[model samples]
Target: MIVTIDGPAGAGKSSAARSLANRLGFRFLDTGAMYRAVVFAALEQGVELTDADALEQVAAQLRIELGDQSVLVNDQDVTRAIRTQAITSATRYAADHPGIRALLVDQQRAAAAGHECVTEGRDQGSVVFPDAECKVFLTASERTRGERRYHDLIARGEQVTLEEVLEKQRERDERDTTRAVGALIQSSDAVVLNTDGMSPDEVVDRLYEIVQQRRVAK
Candidate 1:
């Protein structure tokens, strides 16, 4: 069973999906991390963000390992490294590259083969896992999402203003919707969850219920 949780940035998809996977005893596929890993590698190697060829080369040589509690890129633990605000802002370069997205999508499929997993990302349901057993689109108001992102970045010691964060969020939202490939979209079949005032645990519990229902229906 593959359950995909798709949504815009800062909508708590990562936290909710991770918990939901743990609750269902399934592997968690953080697709965003896969892309961020590529960006992190490029940054580490001083490769330009727009250099698609160089990005492809870096991705092809990278051994990105996603474990329950850690993400390793070429034997280096980048779990925290990839989640920084810098990676978040620069991820679009790698994500927008058709070649890099193909490589990462292949890795995502390989990771889920013969295993039940909960995958979360902007484009999972629409692009990466279109045939997933259960598809969910989690969303909140733009300000709510922006505020969440602001706090998260602040907690991570990133020096960013709320206004700046919100501005960047809007830009990212536009890019996500308009990207040429792997565009972020809500699948028509997806169940939408408006998480304005919901707690994180509530979100996960609801997702668990949805996935269990999907399993039974299957």
Candidate 2:
């Protein structure tokens, strides 16, 4: 079974999905990290973010491996490198490219072909895994999401203010929702989870129950 957890930033999808995967003994696939890996590669290779052709080439040639918490880019461990502000900002460009998205989506599908997976990303339910047995759209209030992001970045020692984080979050939401390809949208059959006041474990438990119900219904 493939369980997709789609959501905007700071909705706790990553943490919840990891927990859900652990509980179910399913593999966890972080699609957003795949895009970030491309961005980090482009930055390291001095490729411009807006150069779609170059970005597509980089995506096609990338050898990315995603472990429990490690991201390897072409035999190099770039787990922490891709999460930097510079790479994070450039990831929007990589993720929005139609060619790059196609390549990565194909890879994501192949990765889950023979194993149960809990995938997390903006377009996991809407685009990458529309036929997934269990699809969940996780969301929270904008203020709450902003605060979560602010604290997370600070914990990572990123020099970002709450106001800046909120502004960037708004911009990302607009772009992600309005983008033409692989847009951030809740699938028609997806169950929406409002995680405004829920803990990560609570969210995971609820999702696990839902997944169990889906499995039985199937």
Q: Of the candidates shown, which would achieve the greatest lDDT relative to the real structure?
A: 1
| lDDT digits (tens) for residues 76-176 of candidate 2 | 99987777767776788988899998999999999889999999999898888888999999999999999988888888899999999888889889888
Which digits, one per residue and each the tens of the lDDT, describe model 1 over residues 118-206? 99998888888889999999999999999999998889889999999999999999999999999999999899998999989898888
Candidate 1 weakest ten by summed lDDT: 206-215
Q: What's the TM-score of each model vs. the native?
A: 0.97, 0.97
lDDT scores of the candidates, listed in order = 0.91, 0.89
What are the C-alpha RMSDs, in order, of all predicted structures? 0.9, 1.0
Residue pair clashes in candidate 2? none
